[model samples]
Target: MTKVQFRTAEERDRAQWADKFTAVAEGNLYRDKNSPFPIHEYFKLGLLGKEVRMLELNAGAALVDHMVADALTELNISSETEGNADEIKDWHKSIFYQDTLEQTARSFFSCGYAAQQVVRDIDPDTNENTYTIITLNSKTWYPTVPTFKYQEIREGRVVSIFSENNDGVKSWYAFVERHTKGNVEHELYKLENGNDLEGTKLKIKDLDRFKELEDSVATDLNHIPIFQIDMTRGAGKYFGQSIFAKIWGNLQEISEIKTQMRMERIKHFRSLLAAPAQSLQRAQRVDDGEALPNNSKQARVEQYEHQATFDLRQEIMAVPPGAQMPQFIQRDLEIITKAMEMIRDCLSEIASVTGCPRSVFNLDEKGTIHVETEKKKDRKYVQRITQCQKKLEWITEQGAKTYFQWKGDKAGKKEITAELDSAFEMTLEEKVDLYRKMNSDGKFISQEEAVRNLFPDMTEEERTEMLQKIQDEDKSLAGSFGDPVPVEL
Candidate 1:
């Protein structure tokens, strides 16, 4: 493969973007030196523990990651396909729902962004078709160009993608290069040597070039094909802001409240475990007119030590005259409870910013959940999920189309695209009601559609059987009870 060299404006723009991408990524991840996350400081101050938490003592960063990512997992995506389209649709189900993809998304959601490339593949032995969706760590992905709106990556918005890879011994670099030659063409680049790729001859390789990339001295692109999935885009910057930006202020408040609560608890427990000692002054009658020791300090110390030595466990102690036991006050449990309320309040504010409900973080102050309030919170949460699902739909479409095309059935693209819907789902009850209302005025309702809503978890065969039984029962009841036969009566 030959390397193409160009000094065009587009190439320079890509180079310039590489510099800015690193800064943007670091800032988003809170890894930049000037960033305000204070993660290290939190650890140093004992706000965040060094040990991994089996039970989360602090709901700071971990809580955010879990709430956002798990919300995304709630999305139900499926394609409505007919005939040959079923093959593409099945491939779509198989690829996108992989555990590895979900894991990648969660990791990215933690830091505000993620990337995955769909590469087409053809089996060698039977010439069967296959595809791979390779997930990339957002930190390693450097875009060739910057985009203002992340909803869609229009043509020319992203010129290329630069990603760094490591194999333990040395670091390797990969680039998904795009250039216009009548139309946009994508070429993958890697280093001739694994050591460094500061300036080297680039090899034009296929998408699978990532696997054998680390060892080869000559730049080579594996034969994997790239098409529409070549566009590098993922869940954009956290709601279009820095991942930690929304929670930064509230996070510190939570930490301070937690630290104060911990300190108060420790003091309270110590007071309970150990009681205060009584101070005593020995009023020994100095011998009247007797010669006392010249060492007045030594004599007083000996007398005081005698009074201090006592068995407190016996509940009685010998003491000099005028001695008194110290009175103790128990720590107020109300103060601790009030502080917990403050922590909950801070979490509630954070939840408002994250589009996560207080209940998700277990920050319920009312003790009981209100169903209507929870439903309202879910609507807000689903709004965010809908935005992400829209992006994933485009990515999935490319994967499905690539699969069908490689299988020598390019016509399946329309079938796959037409039926693809990754939109948010309504409850079965809602769907059933909707269809029933639409058909209330003697309109025909597809039994398959109605049955899907009624018995969503049932298999196709089971649904079919259930629908048949309902139809048979309806016919029998109509015949048996139809307007009492007039002639027979």
Candidate 2:
């Protein structure tokens, strides 16, 4: 029998809150009126929301690796499976623990920076809102996108307080411990002033320490240490566990994806490097000059018949009757023989017989083949040779537009393009041609909006009919955009 675990009161409360969040997301409060969609996939966004999801995934992967290592050293495998476990371990390392550590730093400030564009509700250059949100790709370094604040978030109690163990809570101090390669105690041994935290109390560290820790963490930005250093609060706070946790979580996710991509690139490069070695072996075998296998029982007979034909064409045709038909010449005979041999070889490859030879053919001593061009008379020499011209319709127009005119000439080869639209009377061919030319690139202009740059000519109703026809009534589709219909857990 299988056992099932039920949700506790706390779990139930969390689930209910999630349900409400999803309900609110269905409304278009976050989006413009033109779109009907709400936020997507909120149910599985985790505790910190989608933006901070990297932390959870990173912590999860680390926990999994540690668990597997524990299981292996503790003999957690079956005897029936004889394969080595190193393969599994190596695979894990490649998937999680590789990186190219890059040292780069950036500072974010609410106030305008020296080099940054002066943004306001409207930027003078683009006429966009001043203080328009800026998003950079950060190709050189991992990108950190800050979400704009809207509401207040609750600050939860800190479970493990560091103030009791350390004299002061400093950024550099936290980082020295965070990136220390071993367990907490092992890291403390190598770290400076690890024991100094025992008696002092200065959570009010200076600006230099804060800046130093920030830059230190940024040093090996590729491989981020997270999950273990989860902040008490999540985001939208001053320098606290919440902010660091948010940063750590995002870095962990980026590292995970980069590791996967690097593995693929390495494998591809290895295979490409082996191509030359494979080609060399094939070349060496051919350099020895082994003769290709051939048999000549059928081919030899064809050669003899070819030679006889050549001799007959040259020696016999030079004189009148038997006088012109002299004895076969050896050189002429050899030429005819080569032609027959060539034809026979082709037949042998296909495993078939050649067509029967009806007449002798040979090159003359003057290197010319004879043709009967002198035997023509004057009457009906060449009946007025009438060439059959395949007439095809070619219709060109003022290429195309949202509107077009279909014109065709009476004597024109084209019966097509008589009408631009179906409402216009046109033959099926004409309509097809017009549509083909216009639609070749699969684009069309529709009667959309031509903005009212100036005022309208006449007065009209306060609200246009287009407004009434639009969906003003909010539909309870899946979620809500505005405040949700609250339901207590």
Candidate 3:
């Protein structure tokens, strides 16, 4: 007797997990449904193996994008002091800072951390040094070592390595960037002859053929120019865990359930035709008039059964004359309903793990029975969004300070501040209603306070202008109504 071994839950690889999460986040899962990858293993089962539908709700992308949208809503960053503030704003505009921050947040939420490189360049028009921030691919960048406090970069530094393949010449080369305090180094390497770059056992020696593009630059900053924004860091761990890690199992189950439901629905639509055993044993005429080989009748029946098995498009099943009329096999559709319920439960589980509302996943759209519960979930989700916003705010402020430090503007570095939108999980109508309710009976809240609450992104100047306009409108209404004399009678 032979013993079969199975992989334990603890034996699952983190890299494989990351790859699955990335695929879901990027909407790239099951590109070829027939592929024998482990991720697609569930679909390749039962009688409908090859024909099983690949239905993915892409909950990973939805969760990350929705959280990012909530976290970055109406985000605004400004300077608190005078020197080089306008220049900083201009640089941000030139580099599309808001879009870059959005992409950074997406990456942080999707991949557990976002890596960025600060590149300083000379402005052609002003001939002044300008700073631009660019995100590094998560797979290419590696951060080593972290301080016990705040998890800031320690002595080990950061390295970014990427490979480029030149198909025309059949060559593979690698670009490496090393970032440390006050210095950045760049190097290029070519793969050694007969050494495959993709080989599992390939080493640094295999890519040891140094190309001539070695470069290094020294900076005045006290820390590395690279920034790594972690989603959530564990104690003593250099890398953070992806937000999808907790909900990945639920996501997988949801996909499998949805796929099953789809297959069940297909089965319902194209019911199986049941006939007598000998009915389908007759062979059709061959175009070449070839004689039937031995066991031809059994082979014909098996072929017909295979063709008519799970094919949704097969509308007719022919049988021999005087044979019992084929009857459709009725399936209990209650199984599909049960599967749907299971999917909703899985989504609820995902919502619980992600702090996102189940409504965000498009569950229970027809009624408000779950409205209050979803609102509570929304509030909790908003709190998580606030936490994410704070992280992004810190990153933005640090990025600004770094830019100023690189430009030698010490005053600007001290004064830079970043603010992300604080209002999440509220519609504009809901906010307006809340403001009306707060001030309905009496003036519990002033107009300025209401405006501040309703429109937190407005600048002081804008707020003042808006208040003046409101006051003028009130005076005009009072004049038109002539409120003093008519009410007493």
Candidate 4:
């Protein structure tokens, strides 16, 4: 790789490669439903696998990885002008080539699985031309390299690198050289010696290693080989066959069988997976009325209490000398000093506010105030009457003495007229007759005053005649408040 420029075009190529390769691996490996190859990588990237967090490798996946590496190399070269390009490469060399990043990376390695194929023409039973390549992928969410593998820079070389897990525990893995021919059978055995070395051993078989390769590939795993990738690829003219990324969740019913899992397996999975823990004690506080607990908890917590202090003691000459209080006691002291202080300040302020000299009984929290005013509360008699319905049997001359009471000298001839000529439809003659009924006892002085105010002075005969005329007019004006009813003796 040479110095290259960082470009969007390069990024697109890299992402596309990751997608295409994953799809190719899935389509090829998952030809049949029962195939053990999990299309995890394919599902994740190209959307070709049926299970979650799984990978199915194929020509496409291999190609995607290969091309992505190629692209990265191109990018680093292009970005030569970037800050410390050569310097960065030098640092990487010091780590990777010098076995610095190996320890941590190895802990997360998990294992390495390989499948070998003969690249030459040969007899099915006895062929002697073959080569083996180990494939590597990550189980962690770490995104350093897409994948890695051990390969000999020369022919006739078999290299196996072994190391214990990060915890420095577990039985040493037994890696033995495998040989194979078609229907090849390799011994599933272990290495007697647990050892460590600066390098590894490599076995190169030119004549044939068929049986060995086949047996090794079928180790532990019941299903065919499937490698998961990041994503899928779209259609291109001279590119890969139209590979569809399988959505893993869609075929979840099938994958469920592979995992042998049910909803019960995730009984509290959704809730547990969605959130973090909280602490109950964090909501508590101290005697100062302050809130306690400043954190969250995943479980319940027990609570406690703190009490106030109070005590009473006296110098008892009759008691024994050795028996005594903690010596920190302040006997007969006011336990509620803060409250008492507050009350004292309030009283002092009130004393200055009112010229009453002392305010020992001011309106404090413990005291009461009965405010008295000199003036009486006035009363109003105006009442609203709704639209008149039937009769409102008010005092009439006949029923006057029965219901009405006089609050003055001898009662005057009172007229109780119906609110007429509007809502209830009354005529002036009815009103005059009604008034006369309420004043049956002549009451000349009062009738004279009524007739004068509403009508005007007139002789007894004239008054009768005028009153009749006005009543007739009120009948015409019945819809209006009847022409002011004429008063009479």
Candidate 5:
């Protein structure tokens, strides 16, 4: 098979999807600004109620991840006899679960897309099959060709690349080097000026060395292992459209509403802090009265201002006779209260648009969803989880096949399995009740089957032991003349 020049495609695809990528990046920024990380340090003080370093509300971003995480229940995988069901199940429990695929799915939901690639290899010393899973963030994934289907990326000649500086190191190193020479530490050192070697001035000869060093980093960066791009694309028109993307307008509206509310609050505080409008009693002038002591009206007004500061509730000014008092104006707090109402409405709307229940947003609405209505919501999200399962199924199958091939299995047969029963909805009590109903009137459900349904986390050995105990008890009871008491189903 001819090798595809993936490097060329990476450059081409990055440019092709430049606009969309920009939008995703900006959307992520806006999300962080509105929810967790404040767009500015000062903004945090204004919105979050305190001034601190590196603070943001970040609710908008977290809302997306939380909704997805809460909805995901469990993943069950199994395969045919050729697939080594026991080993596959063990792998699912140990390796797959260790990868925290559900958390990765949360990322996919948050970022509009996420990717996983399967790699197969052998342990040379032990001659045992091994697998490697590569998870990619949205930023690193670029499709060279346009493909609507997530699993059909290979046909589109896609390439996923992750790049980072090595702190002047030449080659790529795994695990330990990740901490000593990886991007994070390097950035920290740069920020702290640790990279500045004192008294080490660069000479002309160093230019060549610097250039060589850069070239070496570039060479190491280009060596990306290509993989098939599989995303849990659930009802999204395109891979770039994240759960947050569709409801971005609403999130933005909520963000704006929050900002406005904060301003209104500030306004209210200022009004409270300020002195209240006072009723002034103007002085009346009598032409026949003794001549005033060269006192001007302006002098009289200043005297009244000085007296008022010392606890004068009302200002009494000496004015010409027949002076009319100005109409009293009251502070109208209703506008601020009305703004609060607007904010509540915006929050409810945001929750509605994002498919999140209003309760999640902490709205005060007393409405409750009907049982059937809730089931519909559950079904909608369950379908999303199923779509993600399909992607995982493909990934696991390919990985298994590769593992068998490395072991010289001619057929190279394998299957990746997934089971998301009832969308993670069975309580122990519920399962037990159902089992009792199923076993009533000689309609017996096997102990193993009942255990499997009730406690999926139980191992086969544990289930077997429990089953044996039940069987032994039944035999002991049968030996007596009375009918054997039935074991709990």
Candidate 6:
């Protein structure tokens, strides 16, 4: 008999939530053939007892992607101070912070939380320290219960564990990385059996298989190197709640309705010919008074039915004398129309829950979205995005600080800051028009100020160079036109 280890409540809950949200985010709701959900009916469709592909309306993916795109569009990260700003920008580019930032946001929105580990190493060519950010799989990474003060989470520790399975090996290895303030720990253990339970407490028998593969190692960094982003925080909750959880019911309803409509179409779209049995039998008889054998009569009736069906596909068909004409059954489309209406309603609810506009998901059948209404609803979403932006900014600053700390650059560490653009802000054209109008009215201080307003991401050095280039261009144009004619006042 094989002994089984059960998962702890915390682990079980996290696993369930992660699986549910992941399925929705990845549009795999019906991947499980035995799923009890109504959406599974979509995948159960069969022709001649063989299952066929079914329609899937993945509203969850649409919602998550739309919000994430809105939040992270035109994202710009930079140092807040002039000190080492250029170096920090270069570091961001070297580490591909933009891509990492988008990945982190996607994970956070889809999985309720995201974790990243900062790795510091030496560059082989320059022998200088290098820093890179690595996004961790939410399922493989666990955070300890956070320290709380006055009903708020102050800090938390993280542990990243993954299993390594070697080919042709019965047993596997587990690698664990633990991060805490001022120290990082690494451990490797070999499991005698492959049944070591993950995200659960170990039993005595399970512990017996845990053989140390190497001595434990610890690194002191004076700061926690793992950065985490949580979608929403609640009191005493270790992990945040996924957005999918709130809108899952609506998504499932939409998918089920879509599946139902698809099934209806498959069943009703074909032209079904209806005729009296007598007509078919009469058409099969060679002569009106000819008496055929029972077996032959049945066979002739079936053959005549098949022929009639095939003939119905043509523009005209000839029927036997005294035989009734077959009439085509009309399909009722009211059910499909109602299903579409229900889907639109569910989309509206999802939009409200997600703090996004219904237009994003094409829920508006009128093809027009109310701008003011959308903007009003988007305010709360914008605030949420701003909060996430701040967290990402903090993460970037922390990573830069860690890099500088490893390099022994105390000033750089102290001066590093990160900035991100608000996705909901005014458009570039709108800003340009406003600035141009202000400058025309003499409300502006100088051209530099206008330039700063237009391009806030540019460094002071870059701004100076840009202004000089403009001035040199103006001088060249003036020279090209020759000296201006002197006019007496």
Question: lDDT per prediction?
Answer: 0.48, 0.23, 0.65, 0.28, 0.47, 0.64
State every prediction's TM-score relative to the real structure.
Answer: 0.50, 0.14, 0.65, 0.14, 0.49, 0.67
Residue lDDT tens for model 4, 88-119: 34433533421321221121111111112122
Candidate 3 lDDT trough over 10 residues, lowest sum: 3-12
Model 5 spans > 4 angstroms off: 1-63, 92-99, 119-130, 146-151, 155-240, 266-340, 351-379, 403-410, 424-489
Q: Candidate 1 residues 389-489, lDDT tens each? A: 44444555655554555555545544344321323367766656656764566434466655764676798789889989989999999988985767854
Write out the backbone clash pairs for model 6: none
Error of 1 at 288 (Å): 34
Indicate the worst ten consecutive residues by lDDT in candidate 4. 381-390
Candidate with best lDDT: 3
Residues 90-169, candidate 5, lDDT per residue (tens digit)?
65565655364664565556665665544444577999756665565444444444355443433122222222456874
Separately for all candidates shown, the number of backbone clashes (residues 3 or more apart, or on different chains) is: 1, 22, 0, 60, 17, 0
Q: State the local distance difference test value for candidate 5.
A: 0.47
The full ranking of all candidates by TM-score, starting with the best, is: 6, 3, 1, 5, 4, 2
- Write the number of the candidate with greater lDDT, choosing between 2 and 4: 4
Against the hidden true structure, what lDDT does model 4 obtain? 0.28
User: Candidate 1 or 5, higher lDDT?
Assistant: 1
Question: RMSD of each candidate?
Answer: 13.2, 35.3, 12.4, 46.1, 15.2, 12.8
User: Candidate 2 residues 308-394, lDDT tens each?
Assistant: 332212212223332322222222234345544543333222111111111111222233443432222111111100000000000
Name the best candidate (by TM-score): 6
Instruction: Assess candidate 6 and give its TM-score to the true structure.
Output: 0.67
